[model samples]
Target chain A: MEEVRNQQVILKDYVNGLPKESDMLLKTSSTILLKLPKGSNGVLVKNLYLSCDPYLCCLMSKSQVSHLESFTPGSPIAGLGVAKVVDSGHSNFKKGDLVWGWTGWEEYTIITAPDALFKIQHTDVPLSYYIGILGVHGMTAYYGFHEICAPKKGEYVFVSAASGAVGQLVGQFAKLTGCYVVGTAGTNKKVELLKNKFGFDEAFNYKDEQDIDEALKRYFPEGIDIYFENVGGKMLDAVLLNMKTNGRISVCGMISQYNLNEEEGVRNLSHIIMKRLHMKGFIVGDHFNLYPKYMEMVIPLIKEEKICYIEDIGEGLESAPAALLGLFSGKNVGKQVVVVAHE
Target chain B: MEEVRNQQVILKDYVNGLPKESDMLLKTSSTILLKLPKGSNGVLVKNLYLSCDPYLCCLMSKSQVSHLESFTPGSPIAGLGVAKVVDSGHSNFKKGDLVWGWTGWEEYTIITAPDALFKIQHTDVPLSYYIGILGVHGMTAYYGFHEICAPKKGEYVFVSAASGAVGQLVGQFAKLTGCYVVGTAGTNKKVELLKNKFGFDEAFNYKDEQDIDEALKRYFPEGIDIYFENVGGKMLDAVLLNMKTNGRISVCGMISQYNLNEEEGVRNLSHIIMKRLHMKGFIVGDHFNLYPKYMEMVIPLIKEEKICYIEDIGEGLESAPAALLGLFSGKNVGKQVVVVAHE
Candidate 1:
């Protein structure tokens, strides 16, 4: 085999408000090889597909995320990616095996934390599914609903950002559990995707609604039992008014308030006390132990055509910046993935 | 006993904003005596000390509180109270037994739900202790801190309304756990009580601080790990900015927002995501089963003088309206309890 080298996309500097292409630089270094050194429990892999998630925006920012170290300037920006094993010094992975995990936004990656990567077993389905449905987002939707909310059958479920990666799956999971699921999306296209594709009980374009509380009232006349909280601020306040007694809210993300200097205040949080509600915020990484269980449940659903997943694929390493930034603008229809290299 | 009677303090009308004395009226009517009927597993008691909790504000408002039935106009307002059983059909209690639970703010009450009431096991402690430390508020502090916050030794705990009934207990609990406990009270008197009587590591007057965030930083150089949230609105927003990563907020009450027509907005909640914090709201009633466990833990603390409790006792049943109104004005020193009867 030819002498191996690593190609990496590095963060030029910490971004301010929004990231630009110039904020990241692509470079190829010939100093190192792909093979894992002796005594090193690492996996050297060829990155196939890289996942672009909203949380990456915070990583790109100068501010450090709590519990997670900020990405160092002039280092490769890391995220979830599907990779093929080139060489492995880890007992869990072998050569030519497909895996997915915290791969750099580049053609190849040498991951020291092989434990973070999951070996791809169900290659019968599209391998790309590992980046979205069967990966972090899938486990997120599963745990956030089943574990956090502990939803009962016939309960009302409301999902914000409902057509996005995690939100779509949450809506579907709610439906499978015999819940009346309604979702809010930013656009008509996404609204249609939520109702038609994800099989939500009802979907509404939040942008079109004059009053969010009114829109919530229209959709949830009886009231919301389980709110899959993806967007916070006013949406959360609106949901508070529409929540049933003993309502449960699983705080997945708050995309709307992430970029702003200040987030909107929720005026109706007092409802939590009166209504006896439970609202909890969680990160998927904290619930990583559930990944294997997530795979077991999701793989069958995907194989039997019981679950449908949509991905907006951006081709090549050049499109990575736009793909990552598209999340803020709601440009991507479903899960946004950038293909760094082909098999 | 003379002819059976039901004497009640009925809410005359739905309160528009701050409740007025005219909004409630006391009426005495002969219906059923304060005696449990045959085969009825209930307790008939004369309420001695009734608590004036902030949550009662929500019930007084026309707006709906989910999972809980709102007090209808012309019906007696109910709250946590210390009572003396006149007669009992429930096997749990005998005549002259001191009890505490859901009881009307009146001379006599017929409790159909005998299971809700807890028989006062230790009368050596003040009977009024049942209205604060040994009652729902105390259990709320217990579960909200130990269970919800899951506080560790040496963690930094912040209690809002620290001189108040529940807040004082929470601060004490945090101190018992080896935490650096800081609290905010409205006045100098309350602040002194928080620091001296409640054994808080630090105490601040929220009204005196020009910048709440700055005050928080000044008091807690290291960020707060656990926030026993009682006052919401701006205090909550300020706390959001000063929270440690993975901090826990146990929302017991939101007194600041309770009286407002349009509740104040919290602009820093997005920090929840960045901090990976956990914020949960709970009712003490939901955790009532922990009463025995609470008593087991707290009774000793009180007897050993390891813990101290304070009460703002209103003189008579006639003073109940002013005592209830005093809560909104921050006039009560500690747990606001009305002494309806002495003998």
Candidate 2:
């Protein structure tokens, strides 16, 4: 068996509050073999591109997410990534077949349960898109907005974290659905990008606003029909007040509260009952059954220029920790992707 | 036109905190008319039993509820009451018809919007029952639990403010639906009433417990499948953390937060995304169209003795304000109703 050098990003311990670069360490694994054991039904993959998602921070915390296990100390952190099969004993995959799903932060991984990876069929688009617009982020925006909100033409939609990977797509989807879409971001530059690049009708820098409730009222004079909740805490409290009667709030991520040790209180939730609001939360992991259907729709949109995707690319596995931690502080402008090895 | 000595419960001004007896004044109308004018479509009714609902406190605040208008300070407080039509120019009701709907908190009221009244179709049950189990409270429990939650058999359910007008019934409905239900109340007596009388599988006195989250875990170790929310604030925050995956929270009322100048912050709402929870809020006013369906189901259950309704009765019109305000302090054991004039 031919062995190769493997470098891995290892979690030193469970993270508390906001993550720092020191929480992760780069380590070289001396005992990793290039081939799977005989009779092992695993696919050995060379990880090409690794996704830096905000949710990994949650997995790194002491709390357990419903569908995912907490990352163990001294182990390589696992997340979604684009990889090519180098060796396989699994029937569904073979050598050189491109696949993307849960993989390690190392240069190579043996995905013991090979079915977790999706075999990439549409490679005409960028292969890295499989970790983003064609993968988790795309499925999240598609299902969380359309399936949850059920928008009608001219309905008002307000997306928080509007310039992020998922929010950008949701805003574009809202525009395409003939809805009046507004977005909120952390900086004026991102706000401009939202209105100009993503086609949002109006966009605002949430940091510049003194009162988010008044800011929302100024934009949605008739009140918001759909709220794509991304940054929770005060933003959610403000959104609760500005939501129209019978409005829908699709809970995707609470980026604001995730890093906080003492999470901020959302005080105005009583408005939910007062306005008969529908607030539903979902995890993208529970919804991969629709990935094929999602690919069918988003692929054409990407080809026809009907949808736009932006990525903040990091160079190597060394840049992965900073890229992932940057999501908490709003450091990355788009989908954060790290190139571990270029094909 | 006939004149009667009408004593009305007048709200002195909009209450800032918990309502007291002095916030309302017993006023005798100087200029009163008991009959409708020529070509007027009003119905003059002699009010019987007045419903003391917790939602009236929301109207008393500066905040606005979607379906119902705020209570005016100088005017007589209005609410759902059982009444007998003494004079009618409306086509739906004639003289001597017993009706239940929105009426002034007085011995007599001119119901300008007569269609708000529902003519008593089933009087085999008590007339006061119309304001409790047969009217708004009944509808609130039925639709909020059944339609919104869509609970399955053997699911674990939890209800807060479990001995109140609506919550008591929700516990019974859960038991009937083949679900295990646990209820939380302020007093041990009410907790006993919930388990012994209402057939809740388990009940606890919230005041006796130090940590609500721990109490919920003790009662619902498997995690709650459905939560019928009545008392909001800290209880809601605790429930959010304890909710099972794909669970539902039906926001019926927030009695604990209503009287506070600043509502408590719900800090654990991010658990919604962690558990993929579905939370919906509703007002009973919008679902009156289902009155026939509700009455068909509830009236038979009442007649068959399959359902039990408990009421904390107040003596007169003078006792109306105290009874309604008592809801905030958990002074009432069950549905608080005032006997303005017995049939």
Candidate 3:
């Protein structure tokens, strides 16, 4: 049995308002045997990449949103990450096998539910890609845009928070579906990437706009047919008014409302009824059944270079806190992934 | 051709905020011909059972909700009503044919789109039902509940504004589907009627509750599986928190939002993501293709006395404005119908 020091990022306390870097602190675990105990169902793995996602804001709270448990204050925050199995008491997993799913924001973890992990079979692509285009974010955009939105060819599409992990994909997916796509981002730098890099038909810096409703009217003169709602509150209200009749809103997450004591009130919801819109919210956990089908479709596009996936890599486990906090302020350029170890 | 004085309820001016009775005034035309011209495609109808519905609030506003034309200030306000065809140039209809659909809030109207009318075939039941359980409200409730919610037996269902036209039918429809149902109305009197008359498992006066979220917890201890959202604003905000995973919200109308300059901001729409909820808003107009099928199912229920429908009827056209304004205040306990003529 081998013992080693495990570097981890622990939640200092339940977060209030926007999470500050001080609310999380780095800790190194005392040496422990890396080998799984006898008859254990857990897999001991070395975590490589950790994903910084907006939904993480929900679990950092003590309020206990129905389906999620709040993060334990002293424990390592668990999130979607890429890991290599060190030893396993789970029969389906073996030493040296690569897997991607929920893992600790640390160097190593004992995952009790190995069944929840998806095996990383395609080494042809970057291993870190598992937490980027091939992981939870990938599954979220695929299902939220393709399944929930059900976009049709030539339909007008709008993506809010357009340069983030999920919104970027949704915008691209809309284009792949032959839809006219426009996107909105908090900064003009991200707005530029949405149009020039992500292939969005039009992109705007929402912060620069005097009135979002007026901006939306200009962008979508005929009205938006599908709105991939990554931001909520006033953005949602204005978008509601701009949606075409029978438009769809695939609510991936409301990054804007996550930190507030009182989430902003979306006042234009009546426009939903007036426009006969379909707004559906989804969690990626519920739709893992489609992951295999998703990889089958998306992997080919990735290999052929037909899909343009962007990455914003944070250097190490120490960067985890700032990396996660950056998502709140639109500091990251694209998919934010924290690399704990290269191998 | 014979002519007669035709009385109308004209919009005094485009209404703002909650519509006041003064916003509409009675007017009489010098004369209206009792016969259609030989080449005209319109059907001359004598309005009988005129419906006063909440959606009319949208058309009354100067801000035109897409898909609806704002009511002309001096024109007779139009709504769904039961009428007798006095003369018809359209081949599908004839003189003395009883029909129900869009008609002016007046004693006489020439419906240019007679194709929109649903011909009244069954006269055994109350003719005014054409505006209640058999008309737009009925179609709204049926499609919104069965088609949109897509409920299964044993699902926990919640209806807001539960004593109104659409909510009442939805509550009854849930019972017919063998689901557990609860409803919220503005008054205890309406609440009792919901439980005793409409067979709801539980009913509460939302106005009486100090905290609607707490009230929802009491009613739906396990959480609501289907939400027939007839009221938006704070009620919708609270209901969002109490919905079950994969819950369905059939957004029939948002009566609370219709009158507000800035409609109440619903802060808890994130519950849509937490519960993976499906929230859809629809217009009854888009779904009339199912009208024939709806009539087949509902007429038998009426005859068998298996379904309960309550109507609040105003004796004459003079009462139309008050009847409509009552909706904003929850003044009507059931479907509100204004009768212009009985023969």
lDDT of 2 by residue, A265-322 (tens): 9899889998999999999888888988988889999999999899999999999999
> How does candidate 3 fare on TM-score?
0.97
Candidate 1 error regions (>4 Å): A1-13, A20-45, A64-76, A85-97, A108-116, A119-121, B1-12, B20-47, B64-78, B85-99, B103-121
lDDT of 3 by residue, A1-343 (tens): 7789899888889987777888888997545579988889999999998999877867888884637688899988888899999999988999999999899988999999899898999999988889878988888899999998888999999999999998889889889999999999989899999999999999999999999999999989999999998899989989988889899999888888887899899888887787888999888888889989999999999999888889899999999889898988889999999999988
What does candidate 1's lDDT look like per residue over A232-252, in tens digits? 988999999989888888888
Q: State the local distance difference test value for candidate 3.
A: 0.89
Candidate 3 residue B305 Cα shift, in angstroms, is: 0.6
At residue B95, give the lDDT of candidate 3: 95
Off by over 4 Å in 3: none
What residue pairs clash in candidate 2, if any at all? none
Question: Candidate 1 docking: what grade?
Answer: medium
Query: For model 3, which pairs clash?
Result: none
Q: Give the C-alpha miss distance for residue B42 in model 3, angstroms.
A: 1.5
**Candidate 3 lDDT, tens digit per residue, B60-137?**
899857476888998889989999999999999999999998999888899998988989989999999988898888
Q: Which of the numbered candidates is closest to the native, going by highest DockQ?
A: 3
Please list the C-alpha lDDT of all candidates, in the order they appear: 0.86, 0.90, 0.89
For candidate 2, what is the TM-score? 0.98
Please state the Cα-based DockQ of model 2 relative to the true two-chain complex.
0.79
